[model samples]
Target: MNSQFWDEKFSLNPNLYGEGPNEFLKEQLSIFAKGKILFPGEGEGRNALYAASLGWDVTALDQSYIAQKHTLLKAEDSGLKLHYLVCDVSHFIPEPESFDLIALIYFHLPLSIRDNVHQTFEKSIRKGGTILIEGFGKKQLKYSSGGPKNEEMLYDIHEIKSSFPNIQWEYEFDGIIHLNEGKGHSGDGHVVRLRGKIK
Candidate 1:
């Protein structure tokens, strides 16, 4: 979906996704020390605000201005601050080796630009920096929980591995998992989870 698509979706509710971080992100990031982090497609600043609360300097990017506004509001409510940009992934240019970690939680993209966007994200992290991702697997179409219906937007193990070739994977898995993020995502779902470090 494009920026307008997302903006309309976000505007439909006060908090489209929720005010809490993704479960996988919360679990995985707990293992690492706090540092500079990036969150792409952070719809409601849930993960970004959680990271900031944990003392990480967080930066988030989303094409939806509504998402950006909600994120900033959440940050303010928690007495924390985060850097948020209103721009699509195709236009977002990250500084090389600027972040210690990056998170992509259910951040799906079209097949036309998915690989290029992943490559850009890979280059934004410093060597040894980690990337954590959790997204709908190709099998998610069988469920009505959430995620894009188009298979091209869903992820698989091979697609993810090829997307970040420069990363040494710590763990990668494709399987069924339950999701309970907010009113938007709730139910058993098929997903691909990956965690790796820049080579």
Candidate 2:
């Protein structure tokens, strides 16, 4: 989907996906202290603002002005400040050894662009930086929950291992999650969750 599609989708409802962070992300963060974080494709800024509340310096990047609008608005409402940027992920290069944490929650891209973006992510992360990602797994089709319908976009643990071979997998798995958010995603869904540290 392009910016127009996303812009229209976000414009249709101001709080389309509700105002909260992902459950799994919250649970995972419980074990570690927050730090400088980069959130790629951070739609509506839920995760970024949440991280900011936890004392993480968050930089959220996305191509949609609609997304940045909601993100900045929500940040202001929550009394949290987040650095929001409008940029395409495929070419948004970051300085190496920059961030202590990187998040890619529910962000998926076409195969042709994914590799380069992933490469940038791999190179930009500090040696000890952690990456947290959550996305629909192939089994999500059975649940019919919100996500891209394309099976190719869905990822598995083995695929992730192969894709980021240099990252040490601290945790990676697939399981069902109950999502009660107001729009787009609501119900039990199968998803892949991963945590890795630069090696």
Candidate 3:
């Protein structure tokens, strides 16, 4: 991923992908108890801020320095503190069994490092901790909603499951859904969602 591209994109929009948390993530967090959580490719920090507001210790990462700045500004506005990092998810492998949850919401990555990133994140969560993911499905190419234009960067259920081989899934979905996430994402979208715990 090019940091310059992302920096420019994030710098241009105040609420690039909206200020509200992803609905799937919001619903999942609602049922969980507060604890330490991580958000890789957290973008402008909507999900991270939400978790922090719920009293969870939140750490978020995005490759763009501009993204980090935007997230910090928002966090300041909400009076919430979050540990934000500016780095690619591939370079980040959190301490094993350290996090209560790891959120992978709309965070698309290159095919080269996708599997490794997924497996590492899967192993980083505590026993019985969850990994929640939501991303554009292969069929998203037919939609105008937010996601990578590169098909290889999109999600495929079988591939996703293979990437996190040890997870005992609690729930999964791969189909179309309505999205209204600011100017960056809108209209109908094809998506894949997963909630799983280590086996």
Give TM per candidate. Answer: 0.97, 0.95, 0.98
The global Cα lDDT (0 to 1) of model 1 is: 0.90
Worst 10 residues of 1 by lDDT: 12-21
Poorly placed runs, candidate 1 (over 4 Å): none
Name the candidate that leads on lDDT.
Answer: 3
- The residue-by-residue lDDT of candidate 2 on 1-199, one tens digit each, is 8888888888997666667888878887777777788989888887788888988888999888998998898788879988999987877989998988888888888777876788788888888888888988888888856888887777776876567766898887789988765587789998889999999
The full ranking of all candidates by TM-score, starting with the best, is 3, 1, 2
- In candidate 3, position 178 carries an lDDT of 96
Give per-residue CA lDDT, model 3, range 2-115, as digits (tens): 899989998888778999999999999999999999999888898999899999999999999998998999899889999999986778878899999999999888888888
Cα deviation in Å at residue 67, candidate 1?
Answer: 0.7
lDDT of 1 by residue, 1-199 (tens): 7788888898887676777888889899899999999999998888898899999999999899989988898777779989999986898988899999999999999999999999999999998999999999999999978999999999988978899989999998899877887777888899999999999
Model 3 regions more than 4 Å off: none
| Each model's backbone clash number | 0, 0, 0
C-alpha lDDT values of all predictions: 0.90, 0.83, 0.91
